[model samples]
Structure formats: C-alpha cells, structure tokens
Target chain A: MKILVPVKQAALVEDDFELRDDGRDVDPDFVDLQLNEWDDYSLETALQLKESHDGIEVVAVTVGDDDAEDALRTCLAKGADRAIRVWDDELGDADPVVIARVLAAVAQRETPDLVLAGTQSSDLGFSATGVAMATFMGWPHAAVVVALDYSPGAATATVERELEGGLRQRLEIDCPAVLTIQLGINTPRYASLRGIKQARSLPVEELTPEDLGLEAQDVGEQACGARVRKMYLPEKGQAEMIEGTPAQQAERIAAIVKEVMGG
Target chain B: MGADRALESGKAVMGGETVEPQTLIGRLLARPDAYAAAGLLAAHPDFADHRLLRMALPDRATGLVFAGMRFSPACLLEELGGWQDSAVQRRLAGNPATPAPVIARLLDNSSADPDVGPRLAAHVRTPTDALPGLVADGRLATRVAAAGHPGAGHGLLLELAGRGEMPVLRVLSARADLSTALLARIWERGDRHVQAELLRAATCPRQLLAAAAHAPHALWRRRAAGHPALPEPVRWRLLRDSDARVRAAVAEAPTTPVELLHRFQADPAQRVRIALARRQDLPPSWLDSLARQPGAWLQRWVARNPCCPRQMLERLAQSAAAEVRRAVSRNPATSAFMLARLAADADPWVRAGAAGRADLYPSVLARLADDTEVDVLGAVAANPSTPAERLAGLAMHDDRDVRRAVAQNPAASAAVLAPLATDPYPLNRFVVSQRDALSLATLEALAGDPEPRIRFIAWKRLGALAASH
Candidate 1:
C-alpha cells in the first residue's frame, strides 16, 4: 500500500510584524517558515500506517518554492520514503483549489492507495484542499478525520470524523479515498538524530507544473476561487480592569455576565 | 574590466539602446558567465532587487555576492541558509533579517561549517528549537551562547542546568525570564556561583531566597540577605548569621526592617556597622554615631553616605586619611564649601572625587579640569556639569579612560561623540556605541568599527531603528 501526504511549509509570523509593500500579505522577514502543525499529524498518520502494514510506502509532496524543500526534508527525516516538491513562478500564493489541482495531478501519477493532507494549513486556513483534490480525482473523501481503521487494499475503511461541539460521526469510506487528517489523530514523533543523518543523504525530487502535466491557467491565479484584496489585523479586544473590594468586583463581573448572556 | 564586458553584453541584449541603470545592472547580472556576473554585482553594491539576485543563484560566484548584501530578503536569506557553500551559510547565520526558522535549519545542518554553529547560537533570531542542537555541539562558547539565548525555553534551560558546566550555568543563571519553578530547579543543581547569581536576579523566588538564607555557605546567605524577595523571618535570621559578611549584607539591604538597623549598629563586626553606614537612607542620628566611631574605615563610609550630617561631613573632611577626605568629597550632603576645599587639596585623587560630583561649582570644575593628572581630568570629563567645549577637548585626551569618560559624559553631544567614535581605544568607541541616543552617522561609523562586538552592537541598534520605522 502507498500513502501520499501533501504538506505545506507554513509561515509562522512573529508577535510584532509588518505587511508587505503591497499590503496583501505579511512581510516575510517577520515570518518563520516551518512544517505546518496539521501536516505533522497527517504525515505521522501515514508513517504510523506504514509501520503496521507490509510493503507500505509513504511519499510526501509539497506545492511550494525552493525553500519549501526544508519541509520535505523534515518529512523525509520522519520516515517518509520519498519527497517531491513542485514549483512554478506563476503559482505564487496559489489558492486552495489551485493547490488541490496540482496535488491531484501528482496523485494521479503516483496512484497511491490513500491520500492524506492536513485539514487546513496554519498560515491560510481555507480547509478545502484535500476534498478539492478528491473531487479532481473522482474519489471518496472525508474531512476532519480523527481516527481511521483500515487494512491494506481493503474495499471499505472505518473512519471517525470530528464535528462541531466535540461530536464525532462514524463512516465507511471506499478504498483509495482522500482524508484530511485533524489534530489529535495521533501524536507525531520528532525526527531522531539518526533519522536526520540519513535524511541528509536522501534526495528530494523536484518538479514543475509542466512535469505534472499542469498548464498555467490550470494552477495559476486564473484558477484561484479567491484573491486576497488586503490583509490587516483585527482590532484587539480590550480587557476591562475591575477595581474595588473582591465582593464588589465579583458583583460587577456577575452583572456584566448577566447582561452579556441576556439573563 | 568584467563589468565593462558585462555592460557591453547587457546593451547587446537590450537592443543596443541605453536602458535605466537598474535595468542595465539586472541584465548584466543575468549574464551566462558566472565570474562576469559576480564582478558586475560586486561593482554595484547597492543593487538590491532580491528577486533578480535570487535568479542569479545558479552561479556559485553569486553566493559570495548574496552572502554580504544586507538587503537580501528573508526568503533569499532562508534559501541561502541551505546553500552548499559554508561561507554563504555563515554570512546568513549573522544576517539580522535571517528568520528564526532559517537559523534553526542552519543549526541542524551545522556540520557544514565549524563557525556556523557558534554564529547561529549567537544570532538574536535563533529560535528555541535550535538550542538543544547547539548544546549538543559540545563547544563551550556555543553552549554559552545557547544558554544566553532569549528563545531558550524552560526545558532547554533545565537540560543546561543539569549539565553543571560553570560557564553554561553562569549564563543560564543570569536569564531573568526563567520561571520561578525552573529557577528553583536550577538552584537545586547546587553550583555556588549559580546560586549566588540566582540570588542576585531580581526575579529569584521567595522560597529560593529563603532556602539560600539557610544554606550553610555564608556567601549564599549573604547574597540571599540582599535579595528583595527574602521573607521577614529569613531577613531576621540572616541579620544574626554567624558570618559577619551575611549580617553586613543584611545591614545594607533596603528591605531590612527599621528595627533590624538598631541591632547592626551594636553588632561586633565593624563591616556590619560600615554596611549600615553605607545605606543612603541611614538616619542622621545613626550617621553621626557611626561617624563618631574610631576607625577611619567606618568613618569614611559614613562620610560617603548622602545622609551623613553636615557637621559629621565637615569633621570627616579634615580626617588625616586622604581616603576619608576623598570620601567626604563624594558625599552629596558635603556643602559646596567643603567640595571647593577638597577640590584644592594637595592630593589629586581627593580633587578627582570632588571633580566627579554633579553639584561641584563650575569655577571649581574649570579649575580641576586643568589638573595635569589624568584621574582628575577623567573625573572632570565625566562630570555632567562640565562644559561641552571642555568635554570635546577631553575626548581627544592622551589617556583612554579620560576619553572614555568624555564619551560617558551625559552632556557630551553629537559633535563631541563623533570624534570619539574613531578614538584610538576600542573601549572609547565601545562607550560611544553604548550611548542611548546616537546619530545615524555615528552608528554607521561604529557599525564598521574594528571590534566585531562593537560592530555587532551598532548593527543591532541600526536593525532596531529600521524595524521601528
């Protein structure tokens, strides 16, 4: 069985940051790029499944520029069998659907038994990539998957999908499905020292849009469903400082809570 | 010249018409010949289009150009971090704009350069994740820098505390950000200097201070005695600590209850009395009584305390010991009359003390400013009341400390400080670099100083200015 994991090198912005000159995104100087937190879980889920099944191959892919190879390297260090990074200058800041198009192309070429992707990247939480890729591939898909029980080459797989308010729904998904892995699905292990040393010698495959038979219009801005017009931080909530004796302060807090709750 | 040839090729590519300088430079940099491209890039140091520069990365020669350009965007810096060339990686390791994650990645790939490990360890932006790898590097300097890193979290600090290496522990002990629980864990490691440093840290917890107060080691108790967080019961116990030094430290601590002050005056140790005498808030009656005591050593401390009575200062001013007269000159309570008398004393050191007083008469400062001795001149130079003209002259003084004093003078302006940035002594420039308000020109000069540490400081200040704007 082969599992495909699509990961993102998410940008972690500093506490104090500035916007780019265009005002559409943050200036990269104040941003630290790391493997996305959600991707860590999805990749770990793939690695764990690989450990349990014989002849299992876990391949990681990312749609990013040159610097994104570090994310792929981290995935490789954590036991992914192969890593591929696809990039094109035209794909600058591709939206979720465009990204899914590229991932689906790669998935079509790889023909893996399962495709796992983060439910949403931390930097841009569109939460649509995995399901969009499933649509492109014409396969069954699930989102916010908290648990999965599957045997290699099984026609049907039992899965637990997390819903709002701490609810979970059980479902049977057909084989060769795509699942967006959620947090708490499993604990991801850090790359061991030996694993890091070995990863240095492992080669990460690089491809372009053309290599995946993708054209400009297919995965470029034209295909994006959304475009960020401007980005700005929302006004921070102000904390009210209550003064007076403890009893008076508690009374004020109770009054405020009652007013807020319409009691 | 390589640039000439590249320019010729660039014009040829541009259809033989004159193009904008930036556009021309971009075309020259994109030439097929790596050496020519590098040469043109080297010639135009101000070329800052990061995208164009990144496009030129296929040429290894361009790595050298990329290495030194301060304006390289963060993405370019991050990409350069993984360059096959260690020299490029080393430069990125020190670049201020290099993101924390890039530093962490370079630290993971640290085997490329022996110097990169320490550079990344010292980098201000290096994230917390890089610290363990730096510590695992096993170099004392690297570990020391890692311990001092602001990003080092409690877990890494705990691991460092377990190591018990003195240098590492010393750096860790100075970190004020550690949690009280973590600090107690570090204190439990039981290195004496670390314990003393922890006691000195303002954030040192109440329990740790109390524990140190009961420690068998008197040094720990003494350091603990002065801690602001020491419990009242612990302070009382420390007042009677068998070690006179511990009792003396308690005597000097501002937190010591007023009732404890009366007990130290009667204490057997003269050091305890002297410590009590040194308190600025010492009662006038107590200062007079301490001054009446026999030893010149005890009397000198009383004379130096601002609370010393005028009569006591007057009498102490005439003491046989030049030290007591000098001490009296340092007292704010000493009348200007006494300062003038001390300023004219035969002892240049006595005059030096009077010269440093902020309240010294301008006439007296002008007189003392002409004193042939460097010490008197240094003190005069450091006095805030000294004329700016005198400071500018003193900045060119033959003695390094005198010049250093001028650099430190509160009244010293940009005109006076500009010359000192090029002073023969690195420390004079170091002092000038530390001024809270410095001109852009002065910072730029110091940013190129021969001393690497001074240059680093200037660049950091410059980076801060850029960030704020």
Candidate 2:
C-alpha cells in the first residue's frame, strides 16, 4: 500500500489568524511555525494504519520554500521512511487553485494509491483547495474525516466528517484519490529522541516544478487572486460601564435589552 | 501549522520514553489530582488539556461542551430540558457528596433559605446589588480578594461570586433581578496588576473610586453610581493608559472640566478627540480650534457644529481632506457661491456634500444630481430642494443607495415614491412607507415588514397619521 502525505511547515499555520491586518498574504518571516494541526492527525492515522497492514510504505511530500526541508524532516521524525521536497522557483502569489494544481502535478509521478492533506490550510482558511484539487483530477473527494476505516486491498476507505450545527455524516470513497483529514482523527505522537537521530539520515529528495513538468505561473502569489488594500486598526467606541448589585444590575440590563429589542 | 511545527522544533524525551496510548493513559491516571486539575483546566480555552481530560470524564459530561467542566449555571438552565441527565442540576439540587464546595454552596434549592444570596457571591468580589447570589456564589469576590484569603484561587468560585450577571440569576436567584460586573479584563499582566485591582474593586458595588464615577472623561468615570473617587495620583496615572478605550474614557467626561478636557485633547487617540467633540457643551471656539486638526473625526465635529468660524470653514473647504471640505460645504450656512464652487470639486465626497445641501444653487444641485459619483447623485436625490420631477427621475437611479436616498427625501412625491414602494432595499421600501402621502393601506402593509426597525418606524408614522385623523 502506498500513501502520499503532504507535509508543510508549521510557521505558516500560526500566522493564519484574523488579526485585523491589511496583508492578505502570509509573511514568511512572521510565520510562527508549528506542525499543521490536521496534518499531524493524518500522519499519525497513516502510521497506525501502516503498522496494522504489512508491506505499507508512507511517502512524505512537501511543497514550500528552503526552510520547508525543516518541516519535511518533521514527517521523517514521526516515522515516515522517505521524503520529497518540490522546489519551486517563485511561488509567491499563488492562490488555492494554483497550489492544488502544483500539488496534483507533484503527486502524479509516484501514482500513490492514497493522497492525504489537512482539510483546510489554517493560514489561508482555504477549505476549497482540496476539493478543487480532487476536481482537477476527477476523483472522489472527502473532507473533514474525523475517523477512517481503510481497506488496502480493496482500495476503499470510509470516513466521518463533522458539520456545523452539531451534525456528523460519513462518506465512503474509492482510493487513488484525495482525502483531507480533520484534526482529532488521532493523537499525533511526539517524535522521540531516537526518532530524531534516525530522521537526519533519512533520504529526502528535492524536485522542482520543472522536474514535475509544471510551469512557473502554475503556483505562487500572483496566481493568488486577492490583494491587501490597507492594514489599519479597527475603529471603536467607549466601553459602557454597568453598575448596581447583581440583582438590580440584571434587571437594568434586562430592561435596557428589552427597550433595545423594542419588546 | 499546529503540531506540524512542533514536529520540526525537535522531538521530545516522550518526556519519559513511552509513546503507547496505554502508557499515556497510565501516566494520566497515575496522578489522581491531575485528573481533577484536568477537569478544572478543561474549561479554559487557553489550554487544550480539556480533550485529554475528556478521556477520563466518565459517561456523563464527557467530550467537548467547549464551556469546560463547570458549566455556566445560566447555560445549564437553558438546557435544563432534562435535569436527570445533568450532573450540574443534581449538584445544585443539594447533593452533599459533590466534591466542589461551589456545587454544594450553589445547591440551597430550599425555597425558605434566607442565606442563599450571600452564599452565592463567588462570581465577583463585591455584591453590586442584593442579588449577590445572582452575581456570585458567596460574599463579593472582592472581600475574598481583599482578605488575600489562602483559598482565593479555588478557581472561579471568586470569579463567579463577583460576576453581576448570568448563571447565578438563572439558577440561583429565586427572586427578582441580577447584578453583574461587565468590567471584564481585556488586558491583564499579573495577579498584582492595577487593572486586576481596579476591576476587582469595581465588581464590589460597595467600593468606589471617586474619579471612576465622575471623572471629566465620560468614559472613565463610569463605575457604580455615587462611588468614591480614585486617589488624585491614581487618576492622573491612568492618563498613561495604553488602551484608547480606557484613555478615551478619561478624556470625554462632563466632569473633566475644561482644563482636563484640553489636556486630553492632545491624546494620541483620534477616537478620544471625536468622543470629546460629541460633548455638545464644548465651546464653539474650541470646536473651531480643533477643526484644523487633520482627521476624519475632527471633520465630523466641524459638520455638527454650525457655529465654526467662516475663516475655519473656508480653510477647511480648501483643506486637502475631502471629508473636512465635505463637512464645510454640507453646512447649510455656507454661501451658495461656496456650494457652487465645491459642487464642481474634483473629489466625489465634496460634490456629494454640495449635492446634499438644500440651500445650494439650483444649478449646482442639478449638476450634482447628475455628477459622476454614484454617492454624489444619491446626495442630490436626498436634497429637499430638488424638484419632485428630479426626485422622480432619480428615484429609479440604478445605485441602491442613491435611489433609497431619493425615496427618503421629504419632498419626494407619493407618485415618485410609489414606484419605489417595492424596492429590493428595505430603506427604499421603508422610506416610501414613511411618506405622509402613503395611504393607510401601504403603511399597514409595511407594519408587517420583516425588518423590525422598519416596522417600528411604520407603527410610529401610522400612530401620527391616526392622531391627525
């Protein structure tokens, strides 16, 4: 069984919050780097499944800048045997589609039976990326898989997803396709000191987009269809002071709310 | 990037060398107090240990409620759909075996219990009102804080007691009303920080800082009514507050007297300057003096204050700030020539302002109504002097804001507003409904509008029409 695990640097994940900034794009310098929340779960689930099923090889792949090698080695430390880093000339303005395109291209060479990624990148909150990637390949897609049951020989996997309004649904799909794993699929075990020593010696191959026969405009920031207008602080008003004993205060609050609600 | 980055940073010692789930579970179960600490810690979103604690939480109250171990009595009351399945309800119903003193103290389900109020003051430091129990679990949390009591960190017992609102009022209050300390800490440093002390002091309704209740800045002096002042130095010390909200409060007080008001005028916060401008009692000269300042808020002041000097008005008109010039030209007192000149101003905002003035030259108003800027055209439509024919023509303007403004004009004829009666934007529909010419049938129809504010306006208009009838 061959599984493709897409690994990314964590620093990019930490910077993906709505901090009232005008900069829509991520600043590599400010990246608070950490392991991707959902990807860790994906890695762990794959490792566990590999342990259960013999003759399984987990292939770790990363699409990023130079420091991404640091992140690729992370998957190695987590027990994956080999890694591949796709070196891109300039991926600066790449939007989600371009990213999916590049990743799809990179995965095409090995033709792994399973390709896994985190449901949505926390940095971009680009949830549609994986689905778009699956669409590009015309393969069945499943998202936010909280739990999974994999049958290697049949190449089929059933997964459960968490939805808004406290709903859960399960979808089963044939493999040789894309699946975005939700966090909490499994607890990612911390890499041990021994695991660290072995990770440095692991074979990590570097391949450029040219190696994958992909063009420059295929990914990066310009292909990204968004811009930052201006980064300015939010306007605010005076905070109201509420007074009185808990009971009187509650009544006043109720009265004020009732008045506002026009009750 | 969560654990992904944690992965590259370097591996752990297993912090003891076992990666198995059973060993992890053993490590967790090995420490009994850690389990209870985990339960208490689960409620804190700042920490994710709650999920780990969920593994041991037994069948009841397991997994993520996201609210943590001790549920807000208010939220529990909301879900009291079935109390038998709820441990919180069971504890509150007087279960002596409950480990938490708060759950036991929170019980007092007895209708005749006179001590329930003081017993539930754990939410806040001091009782803001008679509903101490409604705010807290025991005496005001401030009393406990002031006592520097050994057991203060017994968790949210103090926090809950000091709170003037929420779960306590729903679950603990048998009678009327609930008090709460809305003065939640936004930025706190340490246990001994001044903000913590101030908020704690504020929570206790019995305590007061004279400056907090009646400081010159309307925002700063807003504590309990008739409370004592903060010492003069302390009040002065707050001037350096980094937060604009806190500083703005210090700057916009009615009691701030002219001296402090002028001092706060130099505050770096533009909001504070605007807050001061909102005070109608500020001298016209002062408003004029502040009009020259480069900021949108100062322009807002110039707009509201018609008494600003003609020199300042002309200077403002020539000023690069579009909003400031817009404010100057929008003022009804500005001469027609000024309006005429500004109507042709390159900036869309200045043209929009010129378009809004009822007293502007008719030619200028006409030019503005046909201006390139959609916003300017909208302003022209709202000008009361615009002829009903012009209103009719612009009533169908493609821009929703412009058409809505036209529909809102008092001069807009019923015939003109009628076409826009079913306009997709609620403003246009409601504007037509507000017209005196609108028949009672139309007004009644609008009374059923889905928008509450629109319907409310309709009701008032209907009442006035009824009174005239």
Q: Which candidate leads the pack in lDDT?
A: 1
Alpha-carbon deviation at A89 in model 1, angstroms: 53
Task: Output the worst ten-in-a-row residue range by lDDT, candidate 1 chain B.
Answer: B1-10
lDDT of 2 at B352: 84
User: Residues A138-234, candidate 2, lDDT per residue (tens digit)?
Assistant: 7788888888888776767888888999798988788777888888888777564356557878879988878888766666556666544554346
Estimated TM-score for each candidate: 0.45, 0.36
Compose the digit string of candidate 2's lDDT tens values, residues B170-284. 2222111212332232112112122223432433333335434444534434332212334455556555555566656555545544555675566677877777666666676
Model 2, runs deviating above 4 Å:
A1-263, B1-207, B210-247, B264-304, B331-337, B361-363, B422-427, B430-436, B439-469
User: How is the predicted docking of candidate 2 categorized under the CAPRI scheme?
Assistant: incorrect
Estimate every model's Cα lDDT from 0 to 1.
Answer: 0.79, 0.58
- Model 2 local distance difference test score: 0.58
